[model samples]
Target: MKSSTFKYSMLTVGIAASLGIVSTANAAESAAASTPTIDNVATATYKIGAIAQTPVQSNKVTVNITQSAAFSLTAKNDDGNATDDYNRSAIVTPKGRVAFNHTLTNSGNVEDTYTLSLAQGGTIPGSTQDASSYDLAATNVTYTVYNADGTVKKATTVTGTDFQNTNIVLKPNEHADILISAKTVGNVGGNSQNLTLSAASTFFTNSDTTKATLTNINNSITKVPVFKITSKVSSTLNLNDPSSKVTYTITVRNDETASYAANANNIIVFNGLPEGLRLADQPNLSVSNNATIVPGNEGKGSSSADDSVRVTLLNLEPGQEATITFDVQKDQNETLTNPKNVINHASVSLDLGENQVIYDSTDGTDPKQNTNVFYPAGDDSEVTDGTTNTTTGSDSAAPLVANQRALSIVSPTKKEIPTSTTESTQVTHSVILSNTGKEVEGDKPGEVKFTITPNANNKVTVVTGSVELIYDADNNPNTPNAVYTITRDVNGDNDLSTAVPKNGAPPWTGMAPNSIVTITYKVESNKAVIDTTETTTVSLVLGGQDVPTLGERIAKNTTTVKGLKLVKEQALNENCAASTTLTFTQADVAASPGNCIVYKITAFNDFSNADARFTFNDLVINDTTARFNNKAQVLTTSTSPAFTIRLAEVADANVLPTDNTYGATASSTAVSGTVTNLAPQKYAAMVFAVKINPDGTTTP
Candidate 1:
């Protein structure tokens, strides 16, 4: 059987080789095969037999990628907007139009539509720290967008609510130029506004916003046409005199820049005359550059009042000045009692159809007024002589005789007399009596007398011997030598008992105009008068009669007499005695580098009428050998006055010391302060220690 199987396998192999197929007969023969065995199988597999087997295959998937919608926008100044970067802020007049040119650029990847808006009074983004932001209303503005070639793309006016609704489409990396026109609705200055431009993509709803500020330049640059009016009087003005004629050369100069020439119009110059002056005749008006002049109103019964003059002038170009000459007459009137009434001021105004711009010399914001006061020249007194009157005979003429006299009293030596000592001290005051009125010739030379009265609270003792009388050499050179007498009421009974007279006269007699009399006297005061300000009233008598117009003159002064003492001491040992005469030599300082020295400052307000504050200085250690140990200068004790005492070290040689070494070459330390509110009869003291240096060459 094996031989028969081998022959069959061989025969099958031969047949497979001829048919290109291989058989497993030999492997089956080698294995033990008792019978056809079939085991239980959980699953079954089926393989398709085919002429050819196809390889595993797959279908490839493709996709296209793109960028998400993203964009940004920015605003910049256009080329024609401003030549200089500093010109970003402009000055515009009221009711005037101003334009701001800007470029809106799309700085992002995608095309975007940018919306325009404005913001005011908020934190400005992309601005310098602490920088002032622009502020304005968007309702009064109009704008126009331009294409790259400068052609207008859109023009519209926006309201407050719809200002931010305007939009412009921009391609990626493209920009649009724009001009924003604004009109000033009212008078505003120092105002600022911001223009905000934002861009957003259609795919992306989110938008980015940018800001640019618009500043209104300072008023000095943007002010209306500046017109300066100056006037010059032809002759001096005399108070209460109608004969004098004043020709006023009024110069009106246009000082604004040429850019403001467009706003110039037929300027109406109006000047209102003050009281006591009237228009004399027609004004001589002329303009520079041949500007036409049309008479508006002149003289009485015209559109303008008799006291005011008005004229119409052609447009005045920048740097052009006009001159208007008008004459004014002063009529007879009562003399002014106040000195301020002796001069007057005039105001000028310019009417520019819609706006009345005023240039005030006094207040810049108001109108153009007189920058200087016009004063009355020459002798303006109406008085002639006592008991006599003179008049011009005209109804408007004032009486020649004055109703009152003018006298003035002034102190020359000291305006304030300070009482600094307890002992009875003399305070000398020198005074001058002058007549500041018009000249008067009397039947007999006028007699001018002065009586001085002292305060009742003061112990008045006048130094009769010091009384003197002299003439004012500058004003009254020809006047006779002054004769005066000073009488004091020794008992304060207001009587002329004790009299002292100059060498020539009993009283100031035969005095002339603009004459002056000098008197010097001394008074003695005691502790009873401490802290009491005394006023000495002086009465004047002219021609043996009390001068009603020459009112009484009073002089006031104060006195303070308090005692403060500073004592110094030095000792080789710890124990020391303070003395005012304590002295240290250079040899002593060289011997002991750390010697102990003491200073005792005592303040006593023994007779002070009021609370006192005292200051002491130059409490120093003088050592030429070496510098004193500043840190060792310690406060030893503060007692007495029963008040707080603050002590501090000061620099060297600064205080004005009582000792002769204050301005000397010696090295010294100083200190100063106030012992505030020291009561009468109270005392305070402070003691400090100082260490001398062996070598006085260092400071600490």
Candidate 2:
């Protein structure tokens, strides 16, 4: 042991020196004496069967992808079969065939056994070689299968030896086979389905000699063909008119496991008259197993690798499922040359030019039905004979006696009215049509209408009857002007042209021959006119038959004249000496032009037994400066009461003392005019201050 450790260190140092690992010999000597010690030796045991030292590696992660579509299945004892394998989810279709697909690949370095199978419902266990070291069981992982509607059809756990495929191995760079199939349920046109597949495990294992174990290995479930539809409706084709024939080219494909049948006989059936017509007989049906039908006849018309053809189908498919076309000529029954009644298949006729004829398909039972009466009138004309030859001279007196009738307005004798008042007033007028010429039973009530226009002063409205009139009133009440129109409201038709014919034509036949109507209008006065002359018009119309005589009635208009009256008059009170006379007056005026006179007259006098009296005098007469001559010689007297006292004119001598207020008291008189009294009485008085003058002259 003379220094075994040192000797080993020296050897190491020598090697390091040779390799140029140390600076000098002295450093090497120091390192040689030192004892070599190792830490963590107990934990440094090397893994057996490992070949080479691993280099420092960067962390990396790789993803594995698998795509698939199919149904679900259960585990079975088959050669290298995966337990609880779900090829796909679940699919439900409405019609026809359905298809499924899938893909699988090795996602790891070691070989693995990937099993795919489907079951209605249940769970299967997985297996691993080393039971102590590796676990392939998902530890009660539940596998679920869902229906097309997402309903869970079945659920099971993977427990036993192998949940995936047992004893099956998959090598690196290798992928498994995925199978998809198209299955049919029933029927032809419509189909729908859904399928889903999901993985429920996180562990993987190898059944090799090494019995390796892998963690974090993920299994996935995929949904395949989530939804599918099988049936489709085809376009419609007309079979009557050759032009109606529709060339339908449809690309039909099926993924069903069985061979699909698409023929004229196998297609859906739709039987009925097309739009308003039908075929004369059952059309012939000729076809090629893989060829398209033509327009004229049903036969192998065209062929192509595309499997697309133009078929002229005599019969249409129900809901237009299969596309078929034909020349669709109008059935023999549609041809005009075909008689209304003819023998069955009697040379079905079609009208060709140059008088050429085609036969009709009329049964023998209807012999008369094949007549020309039912045929279209093509440039055919007919004539009727009437008596137009007659003598114009009246050879004998009263040779022919005929009866005629006429109408007249009997009820409303007047039509016009005067609108003078400020308030809107309603004027009613009615017309009675009487058969003045002759009376007949069940006389149809002739329609009567009245039309009115609204004016700034008034608005016209129909109060009792309709306002629709049809006539040619050329300012003529009987007719309407060409620019304006009137008409009867037959069916309430307000179209004037329909009621009263346009282009100078007679009215429609709906209206009665003769009618009479009296129209009345109520007009409102303007807001600013308190009293004014107002004229209103009401048009009366009498048909030619109603008023056979000309100028029977003149268009009369009534004018209303009104005057505004002073409703009330008042006077201000004023004091006057008992010996003086006073008068009150105002200028009377008229608002309208008329031969009227305005007089200055005194109103009421409140003082009778006072010191004052009321009188009116003229200062100038006919441009002559005359003395103030009293006209009203009223005297104040103590015997009279304090009420209104009337003034007397100069012509009345009984109550006169021309200039004197006979007994008015000075302290109690109110006056408005100049006056004089013989004696003074201290009484209260009130007088009207009014003056009357001739020739436009007055005293101040």
Q: Which of the numbered candidates is closest to the native, going by highest lDDT?
A: 1
lDDT for each residue of candidate 1 in 57-161, tens digit (9 for 90 to 100): 111111101111222222233323221221133444434445554455443445556565554322233221112232245334455555545567676666544
TM-scores of all candidate predictions against the true structure? 0.32, 0.18
Residue 400 error for model 1, in Å? 20
Q: What is the lDDT of residue 285 in candidate 1?
A: 45
Q: Please give the clash total of every predicted structure, in order.
A: 16, 96
When superposed on Cα atoms, how far off is each prediction in RMSD? 36.9, 49.5
Error of 1 at 589 (Å): 84
lDDT of 2 by residue, 411-505 (tens): 33222222222222333333333333332311223322222323234322333233333233222475543322344355432232233334675
